[model samples]
Structure formats: structure tokens, C-alpha cells
Target: MDKYKQSLSTSTRPFSQPFCRRLMKPRINYKNISLISRFISQRGKILSRRVNKFTLKQQQLITIAIKQARILSLLPFIKFDII
Candidate 1:
């Protein structure tokens, strides 16, 4: 039992680190299409705070930017693969 437990612990992978520690500073803008696109999924849905690792304020800003960009036709409402 002790050996099995030890083996199990050793076989487990370490927790993954986030790709970017700080994605961006404050003052997120809607005009920055490139930056805003990063926060959106391939399916055209806005990514969550947990996935983006953003604070409450930052997440809210990102959501607003995405919507604004979509309205202005700067970003697509949905991404479709033409295959």
C-alpha cells in the first residue's frame, strides 16, 4: 500500500503554469483588435476570467471591448471554418 501510494504521487504531473503572467496592463481598448482577439475563443465566444487569468475589472473591460468590436465589424461575431 505504501509503495503504491508513493508510485502514484511520483507519476502525477505537476500543475501547469499560465502562458502569460500578466496578459496586459489596465485600460484595455476596443480598437485593439489583435489584443482583444486573443481573449476570444475560436468559436467567437469571450473567454472567461478563470481561463484568461484576469481580475474582475479586466474581464469586464475585455467583454465590453469584444462586444464593441463585434458591433463595429472589427471582429467577427462567429468564426466559421470553411472546410
Candidate 2:
């Protein structure tokens, strides 16, 4: 039992590391299409905070940036594969 418990603990990884190690200072920019795209899914939907592992404030910033980019047509509203 002790050996099993030790092995289980050793095999498990910690969630201490965040998805974004270095966030952009101030806020995420709408004009930065590339950066905004990273937070979007292949289908053009914004990814969730859990997936990005960003704080509430960071997530809100990202959402605003994405929306602004979409409004400017810098980023696509929906991605479509060209056949």
C-alpha cells in the first residue's frame, strides 16, 4: 500500500504552472491580430479562461481585444476551410 501511494504521488503532475507565463503588459491589443488569434479556436470562437489559464482580468482583456478585432474585420468571425 505504501509503495502504491508513493508511486501515485510521484506520477502525478502539479497544476502550479500557468498557461501564460508572460502576459503582455498593460493589456492585450486589438490590432495585434496574431496575438488575438492565439486565444481563438480554429472555429473562430474565443477560448475559455480554463483553457488559457488566465486570470479573470486577463480573460476580460482578451475578450475585449478579440471583439474589437472582429469588429474591425482584422480577425474572421468564423473560420472556413478552403476546399
Q: Write the per-residue lDDT of candidate 2 for residues 1-83, one digit (tens) a residue.
A: 99998998884643333535365644478988877888999899999987886777678888999999999989989999788
- The candidate 2 region of ten consecutive residues with least summed lDDT is 13-22
- Return the TM-score for each candidate structure: 0.68, 0.70
Q: Please list the C-alpha lDDT of all candidates, in the order they appear.
A: 0.80, 0.80
Candidate with best lDDT = 2
User: Which residue pairs clash within candidate 2?
Assistant: none
Residue 13, candidate 1: how far off, in angstroms?
A: 17
> Candidate 1: where are CA atoms >4 Å away?
1-27
Worst 10 residues of 1 by lDDT: 13-22
Error of 2 at 7 (Å): 24
